[model samples]
Target: MTKEQLCEYRELQKEIKRLQARIEKLKDKNEGYVADVVKGSSIEFPYTQHPILIEGFDAEKKQASISRFKELLSKRVEKSMNRSIEIAEFICNIESVKIRTIFEYRYYDLMTWQQIAYKIGVTDESYPRRIHDKFFEDSPN
Candidate 1:
């Protein structure tokens, strides 16, 4: 084969490898989401024992404050979930299924742009940027 043909073959192989890696990453993300759904809420970090020699704060008051903090956190989580569902529905309405999935996985699932590009079978990192531009182009500013 000519040098040009060999170079093209190598490039094609690289692209295929990149696409395979991206698919694996996306599959892993989907598995994680499925596991989370099956498992319900994840375990929280255990509270550590407070130092015996502390400042002048009351122990009861501290415990009360911690409980209140946890309640606030739970509310925030609920609010965020609701907002995410709203955004996902909006994307579903406007974009193609593939682009919508990429948007949801990247922003809602908190995956990196590279990860999203991989899932969509794109070898280039710039694919995520292009997807974002396309999404926004049809969206109201």
Candidate 2:
């Protein structure tokens, strides 16, 4: 992939992970969920045309509708993930282990640069970042 394409690597990883999580939540929602239901209480009036038809909303039907909606949402997330995987894979194919680790920790692990510097045994915060930036800046177009 072109360096320009690789520029989007970090964002793609972040988006892919976010989409994956949403997909999982949607799947879980499809299973089922609890909902608050107010007790059915109908008021009777002397001059009413007919007695209040006091039947609470159908929980079964409501839950089913919610599940279907979640299923639809899951499909959308899956489609987004499909597009994201290509960029994520391209980023992962980077030859340098350190660069890969930087992306993984920064994007996937969601760690600060200070944290990454510490994990990688770099004393200077800018050292890791400089190397990362240099890799991209010096890439042959």
Candidate closest to the true structure, highest TM-score: 2
Off by over 4 Å in 2: 1-50, 58-68
Clash totals for all candidate models: 0, 0
- Encode model 2's per-residue lDDT on 1-141: one tens digit a residue: 554565555565566577567656653453333445344443664543433344444668656776777677667666656656776775588799998888677655767788889999988888777876787777774
Q: Quote each prediction's TM-score.
A: 0.42, 0.56
Model 1, CA-based lDDT: 0.54
How does residue 24 of candidate 2 score in lDDT? 60
- Looking at model 2, report the run of 10 residues with the lowest lDDT sum: 47-56
Off by more than 4 A, model 1: 1-71
TM-score for predicted model 2 compared with the true structure: 0.56
